[model samples]
Target chain A: MREAALSLFSRHGYAAVSMRQIAKEVGVQAGALYNYTPDKQTLLFELMRSHMDDLLSARAATGDSGQDAMARLEAFTRFHIHFHSQRPDEVFIAYMELRNLTPENFEVIEGLRRQYENGLEDILSAGQSDGVFAVSDTKIAAMAVIAMLTGVNTWFQEGGRLSLEEVEQIYWDMVRKSVAANP
Target chain B: MREAALSLFSRHGYAAVSMRQIAKEVGVQAGALYNYTPDKQTLLFELMRSHMDDLLSARAATGDSGQDAMARLEAFTRFHIHFHSQRPDEVFIAYMELRNLTPENFEVIEGLRRQYENGLEDILSAGQSDGVFAVSDTKIAAMAVIAMLTGVNTWFQEGGRLSLEEVEQIYWDMVRKSVAANP
Candidate 1:
């Protein structure tokens, strides 16, 4: 049911989709959806929360925090691009449907997003302390890197001119230098 | 009329906004809007194209292409951030409403976007030639830098911790370092 809602929401913005449409897409009665989610707002909030939960858990599973900041940062870069690439629909909803979320829901989702961003900021801070990263502001740098890495989804295709491996290396190279200590 | 349409489209996804609603917002009869545009899709295309046209013209007005590559890039980084900062609605519609554009309109908007991107890519290529930048792929580098700069719109608020000038400088620092030749 959530999957159908996600597809519909991503295809037609959340405002254009409805419980009935989602229910129909799921091949069930609209009333049945209420059995699962109280309303569309709750459904949207849950979808976003689930995505964030998945992201944080996956980041935790990376288990490379003990490594030096450079290595850890590289892992994050690759992981982010790979994870987002596979979930284009979710990623689209996560960003595009943000405005549709209720205020309280927006805050909760923003908090989770901030939590994810802090994962990168922490690495940048550690690298700065180690005299390896020359980042002027760890928080800003984290956001900048994240936006750049995720931008890959806008144009990247599986069988395009460059393989994902190649693309990842290219981005990793830029990411490494973007925060490296000035020579 | 376009203003009202842009506002509505950005606030509510393009799919959800009706022509009648746009007309009401613009203080006109619904039929009156047809005198200005053939339909809602054309209205959207016009808004998007106008925004891109404004961007390209503004970019041209920056008039720093004659400068050294590094200086030119800094100008672009600041210009992009500043220009986008002032037009949050257009920026939002431009990104969010792309999926709603007719296929032909999408191609046209995309081509204009590529033209703007090529502006930055040309600078990166020049920088690489001058040995001031070490970007492995100018195309990818351009996209990365633009994405990073525009991401400022997602969080930056006026009277916040950083002034626009300060934010520009911070992003310029990261962008400059991101493509600087490895020492």
Candidate 2:
């Protein structure tokens, strides 16, 4: 049911998708769907929450804390690109459907998002302290780096001019230089 | 009517907004809207096309060609952040409503977008030739730089921690370093 809702919401924006439509996609009655999800709003919130949860858990599993700041930053860059690229639908909805989320739900999702961002900011802050990175603001740098990496999904295709590995390297190079104390 | 449609589309995704709602927002009958746009699809395409045209024309008006590559890049960076910051509705719709556009309309809008991106790519290429920037791939670099700059819209606010000017400067610094031959 979640898969059906996600695919529908991704193809059509959240506001445009209906519970009945999701039910049809899942081969269930609309009434039966309500048992699983109280309403469309809850469904949307669940999808977004799960996405963030998955992201945070995956990030935690990277064991990046054991590495130094520079290594952790590189791991973050590559991991972000790889993780987000594989889930274009979720990424799209996570961004495009933010406005559709109720104010309370929005706050929850934003909190989760900030937690993930703080992971990167910690790396930047550590690097800054160690004199390895020269970022003006670690918070802003975290946002900037995520934005640049997430952008890979906008135009990247598997068989495009560059492989994901090559693209990651190119971006890793730019990202490394963007914060390096001495490039 | 265009204003009403843009607002409605921005608040509710294009597929969810009805012509009737747009007409109501404009204080007109639903039938009256057809006189301006034959259908919602046309209205969406017009909104997107007009945004791209406005962006490209504004970019052209900057007249960055006379400047050196480094100066042109700065101009482009500051210009993009400023122009996009002023038009959140258009920027949001331009990025989010892309999936709703018909293929033909998508191609047209995409062409205009590419023209704008190509302008930045030209600057990056120029910098590469002049040995001022050490970017690996100018096209990817252009995309990366653009993604980083446009990201200002995601978190920037009027009374936030930094003024837009300060934010622009910070981003310019990152951008300049990201591509600079020596940082």
Candidate 3:
């Protein structure tokens, strides 16, 4: 049901989607949605929060292991691209509908986002320190990587000419080269 | 008046903003706004279309001057970052409020966007032909660069730690390294 709401919210702007519309899509009474979320804002917030948490935890579970910084960065890039491809609607809603979040909810999601970004920044910093990666600015480089990966969700389609795995590999290659130590 | 409307649209969002509210922001009667835009959709379309046109023209007027593909790419990157920084409101509205555009207007803006993307793609193709770039996929690489450059609008502030020039330099360096033939 929340998934249905997410799709609707993503396709139609958050402000334009109503409780009744979500309920209709879910084949339930509008009041029933209140049992899950207090209001539209809460629903939107929970959806984004849960999506981001899943993203973070998924990466965490992958573990840094014995991989080098560049390898770890590549792993993260592939995971990000794959995860977003699998849940394009949710990812789109999380990014494009973020403005609709209330102040309290917005802060929660934004913090999660910052943590995720910090993960990449940490990798870039480590790589730079280890002389495995070279970048002009770790902060901007991290943001650039995140932005580039997120863009795949905007245009990627299932069963497209480039499979998800292929796209991931290509992006990882680009990212690795972008911050390569000797570059 | 359009500036006020653009601000509200960027902050509050397109669907959430109304003609009366825009008129109030401009200190004019709601009916007076009709003289400029027939409706909210038209207003949104015009704002985005004009901004994209200005961006394209700005790049075109920057002069070719026998600059190599890499040099042209750098100039384009710097111009993009600076332009987006100066008109953050329009950039925000152009991206986030795109859904509010009518189908006809949407296609117009989308075409312009494709043209801009293709412009970058063309540069990449030329660079590859000149043995200056080593991109595995020109289309995806173009998208990545555009996404990264446009993302500056999301986080850049006039008085931020990094000056516009510094930001451009870092990003340009990243892009060059990302696609350099010998990196």
- For candidate 2, write residues B72-133 as lDDT tens digits: 99999999999999999999999988998999999999999999899999999998999999
Window of ten residues with lowest summed lDDT in model 3 chain B:
B91-100
How high is the CA lDDT of each candidate model? Answer: 0.93, 0.93, 0.84
Write the residue-wise lDDT of candidate 3 on A1-183 in tens digits.
788888888777778778999999999999998888888877888889899889999989999867889788988898888888888778767767777787888889989999999999999999999999889889899998888788887678877888888888778877888888885
TM-score of chain A of 3: 0.94
DockQ of each: 0.76, 0.88, 0.64
Q: Whose TM-score is higher: candidate 1's or candidate 3's?
A: 1
lDDT per residue (tens digit) for residues B1-183 in model 1: 999998999889899999999999999999999999999999999999999999999999889956999899999999999999999999988988899999999999999999999999999999899999998899999999999999999999999999999999999999999998853
Order of the predicted models by DockQ, top scorer first: 2, 1, 3
Model 1 residue A168 lDDT? 94
Q: Which 10-residue span in candidate 3 chain A carries the lowest summed lDDT?
A: A91-100
lDDT comparison, 1 vs 3, better candidate: 1
Candidate whose DockQ is highest: 2
Give the TM-score (vs. native) of candidate 1.
Answer: 0.98
Tell me the fnat of candidate 3.
0.68
Separately for all candidates shown, the number of backbone clashes (residues 3 or more apart, or on different chains) is 0, 0, 0
